[model samples]
Target: MSENETQAEVGTTRRGWTASKVLIAVVLTAVVTFGMTALLVNILERRTESAQPNHNVVELSDTTYDPAVWGQNYPQQYESYLRTEEMGLTVYGGSQPIELTPSETDPRSVGSSSRLEDDPRLRIMWAGYAFAKGYTHARGHEWMLEDQRYTVRVLDFNQPGTCLNCHASMPEVYDELGNGDREAGFDTVNAMTYSEATQHASGPVACIDCHDPDTMSLRITRPAFVTGIAALKASEGIEDYDVNRDATTDEMRSYVCAQCHVEYYFDGDAGNRLTFPWAEGNHIDDIWKYYEEDGHIDFEHEITGASILKAQHPEFEIWSQGVHADAGVSCADCHMSYDRSAAQKVTDHHINSPLFDANASCGTCHSDDAETLVNRVVTLQDRFVVSRNQAFDALVSLIYNIEEGMANGVDEDSLDLAREYQNKASFYLDFVYSENSYGFHAPDYTQSVLIDSMDASRMGELALEGASREDLEASEVTQKYAQDIEDRSDLEFLR
Candidate 1:
């Protein structure tokens, strides 16, 4: 009896031991699984933190115009912003500091003996304008103030305070003007002479231009941009629109850049007030119409007495016509590509062409590698340059013919008509010349504008002289340009 009872108790004890072991194993497995997951999560969090920039150094003031002051708070952003001083030139465009000595001042010495001299034709095209004094490619934001200050165009002091609108830290100038009140500084600065305004000029395009200090949010600080955005909205029939209040975040990404990278003129009636001619539209022809309707001319040509308009770098307007804008890509998307450093991701403040950092800029979206993307951009630029040269040639010939007619005692009435054509031709040509993108922003739109310029120039030549359109078109330059245009005509447009 004792053996049977002992055996039953041992079997039950064995079963209980087995069940306990199984339970213990299940609990241990659960614990290990949970521990591994926690460890993995912790590693990921550290990696994320390592990749992000998280500096909170200082409280930036609303009136802070010094990039150094802003840099103290956002070191990564400030460091990148400082990169704008890097002046590496590409084939069609980028930045190169030009030195104009006393010897290089002669208009005839351009592009021949002087490395910095622009094309010889620019001298005649911009005759009677400040540009004829000097023209150079724009560099980074760091050089904005320095370049404008040293340019021969500013030596005579003929330009007004409005000229500093794009070149200097407007906020710094405004602070001085408004006695520390940035809001009031704008109007005060606008009323000053170029000589006086430059006294307060600060280096580079600063943070205050595009950011709100209190919140550090991207904002439009320039008064002209505020007005221009409103006008742009009004033209689009968007009622009650205000940039400060109504613009979307994506819109601001592009709008903030539109502040300086646009076409503008100084008002004659309002003491040369900085103005965007978007009163009509942003299209090339639209601006042309704006000048005619407003009877605004940048300068009266010395030789032909033609009142001509100078096209500023209208990157924003031209980009608006491109595929990037259509696809909702903002200027900052390419130019100010997001950068990662020290566990921080900030918008690259380099503010340069996409070509500068193709991988980060174009590679983010483009399936093509950097080399292919660059080649594509170069191809577009090459097409633009060919047409651009042809337009230049036609305009130069037209200028010569008009001058000849004026000298030959062409009737005042006919000369006036010819002058009008000259204005159109010059505007068309200058539109291409001043644009920094080399028509890559809107290839189709660029070609159309150039063709118009070429046609108008030829017409002006014909009007001044008895030469037929066919005769004008038969030139080697025109023939070569026409063929290039034709070849690109069928190619799919980026816009």
Candidate 2:
């Protein structure tokens, strides 16, 4: 009776074990099958994404002045574009956010640090000009319009609508002013007062300024740049050259930026028409020659009593002379490097110095690590600063000498000659100084300009010591073009 009971219990135990094995096998098989299905689904989804094109959610046109509108169709780019509002500093450039005590005159509670306060010499350099009244470190694209509106230069002084050309989105304003004719609108706006012209602008620079809405391709929209580039090409013996038509995609990448970044002046004779003095060429020497022939003087120095020329930011001109330009590297290549967003690759819209993200920006071309690339940039900048400071000091000394000479009753003719020298030295120094790159754009070229500036200052000092005009004459090239200097006495400062 015991054997039969034991055998029955053993058989029951074996059946229980076999049933547990079957249950475990079923669970394992189900888990593996589920994992494989999930992987297959992910692969299919990615493949579909790769094959599909970007779907436009909304129609865009010339009048689309709001970046947010463009963002609807290109969310990845728009998201990056919004980052321009994020303020931070690099080694030598980029804006540092500072707290501003909001006042009745300026409602801004935040702003970039003041370049004038950082270096008082700038005030002296720009004295008798609106820039002396206000000059601050530049913020990103998002702040372009607001910063221009609130700056003391615009607040206390009179400026033409030309100032708004680069600071704000001009397409809508141009359309409104010219009754749908952008060029005609550009002309009318340039003639209006800054306060008046600014009323027409809807916002700061937007996608419309740089892109063709239908095709999403880069195009030049600024009239000043259009004419300027044409003049430059004509000088190079290319007749009727048109930037929008002639420039390649790579060239357009840089040209779009050059529209606002180069040196410019207002043509007062033509209703204060905003103009780029690119008729001669884009180099500093070419620009000086063009100004000499045009006889354009920015202002008369309050302290030195010399006709002074103020240089706007000349990034494009400087960059054109740099090695990177020779290598065919466009501004977008570094500042707006391409990035992968899910299945799509798009240009980053957070426009800032490449140093901020060297890996994404410089690492594309250079094999070096991010830190090394950044360090290289800083090193170039450090050398530039050293040279710039020396040239600046010399120019300041010349200014003081001219002032002292005037006060001490130096001969009128001698003082006049000294003043002329001061003008040359001042302009040359200002050209390099106002450049945002701090000379990193063209190190050797910048240094050469500084050397000429120092030489000009020395000549001015010699002139103060009663040196004859012949003794203080400039280079052969300058001497040859001496008679071309135009009389701008009748011209009024448009500021």
Q: Pick the candidate with the highest lDDT.
A: 2
> Per-residue lDDT of 57-175 in model 2, one digit per residue for the tens?
45577765666668866877888886776677999989887777768887666679988988899888888999987888887887787788889889998888889999888888899
In model 1, residue pairs whose N, Cα or C atoms come closer than 3 Å (at least 3 residues apart or on different chains), thus clashing, are: 50-343, 51-343, 51-344, 52-343, 52-344, 53-343, 53-344
Global lDDT of each candidate: 0.75, 0.83
Query: Model 2 off-target regions past 4 Å?
Result: 1-48, 51-53, 340-343, 474-495
Taking all chains together, the TM-score of candidate 2 against the true structure is: 0.85
Q: Candidate 2, residue 21: CA error in Å? A: 71
lDDT of 1 by residue, 181-210 (tens): 865777767778777887777455788888
Q: Which ten residues in a row have the lowest lDDT in candidate 2?
A: 9-18
